[model samples]
Target: MSSGSPLLADLIEALRCLPGVGGKSAQRMAFHLLERERERGLKLADTLHEAMQRIGHCTRCRNFSEEPMCTICSNASRDRHLLCVVESPVDLAAIEQATGYRGQYFVLMGRLSPLDGLGPQELGLDLLSERLGEGEIEEMILATNPTVEGEATAHYLAQLARAAGIKPTRLAHGVPLGGELEYVDRGTLAHAFGSRLSVD
Candidate 1:
């Protein structure tokens, strides 16, 4: 439903570029911005433009940063001997917020999906190998998601860590912390059962 105004239609179309934003949602957002949040919308547009121009990947960890080195990489107090391998910056943020891990990180950016044209080279394995050769990291944590492609990527990372003489560890996969076994999915239940640990 084009509102007969090309500028309004263009705004809605532009909003559709955001992930999960369909035509209807984009139209709603565009209407909201025009109706009551014009000032805030302008601020958001300015900030988005600035961020797009200024944000670049950290040379060391591949995380988004405005500087050459991100804050985590520049922090001297963080453990240099522990490097966590994650599939995305969001995963890194989640780990940072959820756990007390104060280690360096290597973001893969994407997993190993051959069909999608994402491979080791795309994920910057060469850079990761170079970092691994530096000999500072004692352990490499494989924190990729539990999906098929993620598991494949994690296996490859584990092999890379082993070749570099660093211990490789994986994030435990199974049922949620406070969930009952009967309610858990079949795959999750089976995995948890197979990887069960002995209670102390």
Candidate 2:
């Protein structure tokens, strides 16, 4: 083990586990947090612990929520006729920031990857079928990442949307090529949502 305190290195390693956070970034963040006020670090730890303990999948949309239904799903004034299906809660948040898409969402944990052994069943697509049968949804915007797996998942969802008799659409070409929705800027995401093309 390094001579430094185990707590410092442990914090860096833990931070490195976040997606896209490299070792250098994690180390930098760990040092920054260590240099921060005691209350700030403790607050961060407490907030993380509280979120993990209280937050769970929303029953209606499968998005992260502290309650049985997420705010988007339980809102009385939000549009209920359109649904946006994304691959993760992070993507849902990105879209919400980029567009005024006041609709419901379904978070698929994984995309359809045959080689990786990920399929509709593994992605909880059965839940989608049950959701579709509820009868209020009329449109589904597939905002999966622009990767190969994302394309495959979009097509798979298109098939399901067709079966459900709901129109399916894909994001427009504003996002950078091969970029994930989470990485796109707000302007690009808004343009994509405004100019979306039907995938049917």
Candidate-wise lDDT, in order: 0.95, 0.87
Q: lDDT, candidate 1, residue 74?
A: 95
The per-residue C-alpha lDDT of model 2 at residue 104 equals: 81
Candidate 1 per-residue lDDT over residues 1-200, each given as its tens digit: 65989999999999999999999999999999999999999999999999999999999999999999999999999999999999999999999999999999999999999999998899999999999999999999999999999999999999999999999999988999899888999999998889999999
**Residue-level lDDT tens digits of model 2 in 96-190:** 89888888889987688879898878888888999887888999999999887898889889999999999999986687779999989897799
* TM-score of each model, paired residue for residue: 0.91, 0.75
Ten residues in sequence with the least summed lDDT for candidate 2: 1-10
For all candidates, the clash counts are 0, 0
Model 2: residue 56 alpha-carbon error in angstroms? 2.1
**Which ranges of candidate 1 are over 4 A from the true structure?**
1-4
> After superposition on all CA atoms, what RMSD does each candidate show versus the true structure?
1.7, 6.6
| Clash-forming residue pairs, model 2 | none
